[model samples]
Target: MSAHRLPGSGPLMVFGGPYSNLEATRALRALATAKGIAPENCICTGDLVAYCARPNDTLAQIREWGCTAIMGNCEESLVAQAIDCGCGFEAGSACDALSIDWYRFASARVTAEEREWVAQLPRQLGFQWNGLDIHVTHGAPSKTNRFLFASSKASSKREELDSTPAHVMLAGHCGIPFGETFDRENGDQGYWLNSGAIGMPANDGTADGWYLLLEPLAERVRASWHRLHYDAHSEQRSMIAEGLDNGYARALTSGLWPSMDVLPAAEREQRGIALQPPALMIEPNH
Candidate 1:
């Protein structure tokens, strides 16, 4: 139930939260092509369709590229024919409101084939490489809608990790990229890697999106986060042209989310400051 053997056995690229920006999605695929990571080796953590202007285009891009994707809360909502996005946003919150617009847009545009494809996507993906077992999920093991942040309880994450029995976990849905290493000596050592969301900015006051590159090593897996440069001006233009919603449209260019609806206090405090994550930074002890 948990193990998959990737045919190529090459480095895999992981990303999340495409949010319907065709341009951003295209840029990501371009990066993969440049790196020679094929569609089978490139995995998306989910929400492939959401807040941007080109939901259909984004879906088409992913489909055309043939990357493997895990169903996010958005896909779950759409697949089950839920009225609103199952993002777990509170009613009347900014996220909830904005979500209504994008969700409706995405729901209306996704074709039958896309919906069927989304419905068929696996909830959890497991594969082995370099003597390590890697598990991929959109959120935590508990629910696809759950938001696991960098500041989320280590105890909570450890408890979730306990469920999978994996040496490393790749998670999405929090929209922030971070790599956390748990000590695990006293049941405290493991790695939680978030590829972040490529569709939207990280609220670091920059337009660059985030993705993770995992390279297998002799002793451990070396995972690093990279900032993706795309044309936010064009992404914003598309949003406005589509007449979806101005709040998210501006967020595209500003690189700061219009609403702090989902961000926790720790993340909210660091808003607007550019985040340049360290490079090739993780030397795992797994």
Candidate 2:
């Protein structure tokens, strides 16, 4: 649970779930590099490999670039040699079945050294920015695979925030970008942010994935969600070529999950609708 401190005054780029899409990974890194966002300032919420082709290549890109990343549930499962993806899908569910195909493919492809590297990854990361204590995780602080969607109740987010001393909690694994602020006694406030995934679409009927940028202004910190555009056709073609022709492969183009099994009812209702993540401006305590 040790934290990785990011030093510098530049905007911090946050993203997650590379999910083994090498094309998207490369594009994202290229954009980050072009923006002069140093590798240290870019944080990945993990799942470097998942339901896509080219697991080895995708992980290689991440390692070569040397960004700050925490261990996601996929890494935990792979490192433990678990039989499944550790996504917490129920038994006999379509997600579970679909996971079996890709998990086996990824597990077989990743090297022993890579598994060791994944095992060594910290489960969470922390740093201080603009007078706020920021913590990052692949999922909720309490659980690696816990799904905290935008529609999750306010009380749930409050309890999650109360579990830690973080002023802001940034996480992934839910595959959607959102920002929420909770009220506390004496006018104190806490924040939860999901940067979404760069490797897959937000089920928003678009081929674009998402990332987040945190820019510290003079009076407040600005958190903005951005859509990452890459060649979804190329990614889909690769998956099809590799026989990964499953839900995730098609999800790249359709922007719809093959199954609603993992999503809450509210999120299920949002399938195929375009996502417009709101920008949040947070003021420092006076």
Candidate 3:
């Protein structure tokens, strides 16, 4: 329920799931700096540390950039000193088992101050661009660990949208980039966008990650998803060197997940298929 409002003039760059991939994190920061986007205008949807090898280094990079970040399930678990990641993966499933390895590695690597900083991060945030209210969260408004996929039913998305006061929801944690708008018969319109993960591939049979940019254009905001190309082979090498044997290490090069246990039926069926997220123009319904 804690909401921080971000003021947007130029494009607001949003990404998620650094996942301890130092290479991707560094690439994203370099891209933002080269484009002259202020650090404050760059928002991260959390999971700053997760499956990759350089958890502490990744956290350092994000902090140095000073990007506005929300707490993801991974951050929540790490901050709370919980037993497992809050991703809601089924017990004894592939995701759960794999998380055990990375979670332990990340938990042991982060500094005490880093843990405190993550513990204090807000669960949700709000901002405005081109007169449209935008909400940023790690998952659905109702649950930090909720999985709101692009393939979810329209009614489900509508329900999540109605639960929040913002006109648009910019979210992450599902690791897939999508922009969907829900319009009601009463003329109310809502937006749900997941810029996808910067630290990890979109399971699209490509090594490139994804990010989103929202640019104001007079009367509307243009929300565009862009692919991020980084040195995945280097990251994977680091992971192997660090003794991390999770499937995600190879996923960096293969652009596929080690397990489909976390994905819904629709998503599971589309595994290894490349994604081409389209640009969306959002205008105020009021």
Please write out the lDDT profile of model 1 over residues 87-193, one tens digit for every residue.
99999998888889888888888888888878888888877766667788888888888888988888777777778867688899988898887755345467788
What ranking emerges by lDDT with the best candidate at the front? Answer: 2, 3, 1
The residue pairs that clash in candidate 1, if any, are: 183-188, 183-189, 184-188, 184-189
* Model 1 spans with C-alpha error above 4 angstroms: 1-7, 185-188, 279-286
lDDT for each of the candidates? Answer: 0.82, 0.88, 0.88
Model 2: per-residue Cα lDDT over 85-115, one tens digit each: 9999999999899999999999999999989
Clashing pairs for predicted structure model 2, backbone only: none
* TM-score, structure 2 vs. true: 0.96
User: Global CA lDDT of candidate 2, please?
Assistant: 0.88
Looking at candidate 1, what is the lDDT of residue 218? 72
Query: What digit string (tens of lDDT, one per residue) describes model 3 on residues 1-286?
Result: 1124364588889999999999999999999999988788889998988999998889888888888899999999998899888889989998989999899888998899999888878888876667887788898888988888988887777777777778888899999999998885456888888999999899989999999999888888899999999999999999999998568988999999998887889888889899988899998758
Clashes of each: 4, 0, 0
Measured over all alpha carbons after superposition, the RMSD of each candidate to the real structure, in angstroms, is 2.5, 1.8, 2.0
User: For candidate 3, what is the lDDT?
Assistant: 0.88
Q: What's the lDDT for candidate 1? A: 0.82
